[model samples]
Target: MVLSQMDAGKALTAAAAKGNPEEVQRILEELRVHPDTLNEFGRTALQVMMMGNAKIAGLLLEKGADPNVQDKHGIAPAHDAARTGFLDTLQVLVEHGASVNLPDQNGALPIHIAIREGHRDVVEFLAPQSDLKHATVSGQTAVDVARASCVPHMMDALFAHVHS
Candidate 1:
């Protein structure tokens, strides 16, 4: 049962998006599909993968998926993980060399997203790795995001990593 290139790309991305690491692994190994294969929509498996599934993230990454791969919007897997509060997945991505400081088209880094979303744990994890002084397109830093969030814990967590 051989699949066309398009079919294989679709299957790979679909399996990743579903968080089925087994299926994703099978598609990559059995189909000889590249881990970075793009779906018909021009998005890679990592871009659409389940943000909470660190296993899937690890599998894709270990198989050569680009850790820095980004969507047209400049949103990387780390950004998605941070947005979804999946600290484990974000950690896996960073371990694979994803840049925590990579900003999206809006100049929003993963830390900014985590802070704005009130994910204190995620913010804490990202704080040390992210450029806290970097501003978003709107000229807002991570501190500004936490301050606007009105979440004291978020500020506390971010401030804990800030040297100054």
Candidate 2:
């Protein structure tokens, strides 16, 4: 029996998780699976790209995946990419219209997650695009997280945006 679209989507998610860009490409091309197809966890292919390489993210974006689609926790693909230090992927999502200030279920912004994960570059890239004053679920702002974590670059980025 032929696999349904949902099965193909699951396969795409698996391929992405394993960093198998070719398999993802084949599934997108051959199976005609949706680029933004949601897996069992309600995470779209774009969210899967968060932990994967830049190529897969780019391919998914090219195929029309919505960067803003959130997972079960309300964390967008941009949040995951930033949290995991996937700089290029984060950039692509941002360029493709992912809102930097969009918060997750925990109300944590992308910059907050970046700083939490010690991904300074991601924090720097996102800070300027976000409001440092926004608070998270834990009652902490981006500036607060940066300071508490002692991430100088993140702190500097936030201050620059705030003072500018």
Top-scoring candidate (TM-score): 1
Tens digit per residue, CA lDDT, model 2, 1-164 = 46776787788888888788898899888778888776776666767653748888878878888878887789888888887898888888888888998889989988888888898778778877887888997899887898899756667666767753
Alpha-carbon shift of residue 88 in model 2 (angstroms): 1.1
RMSDs, each prediction?
1.0, 1.9
Best by lDDT: 1
Candidate 1 lDDT, 97-123, residue by residue in tens? 999999999999999999888888999
Clashes in model 2: which pairs?
none
Error in Å for residue 61 of model 2: 1.1
TM-score for each candidate, following the candidate numbering: 0.97, 0.89
lDDT of each: 0.91, 0.81
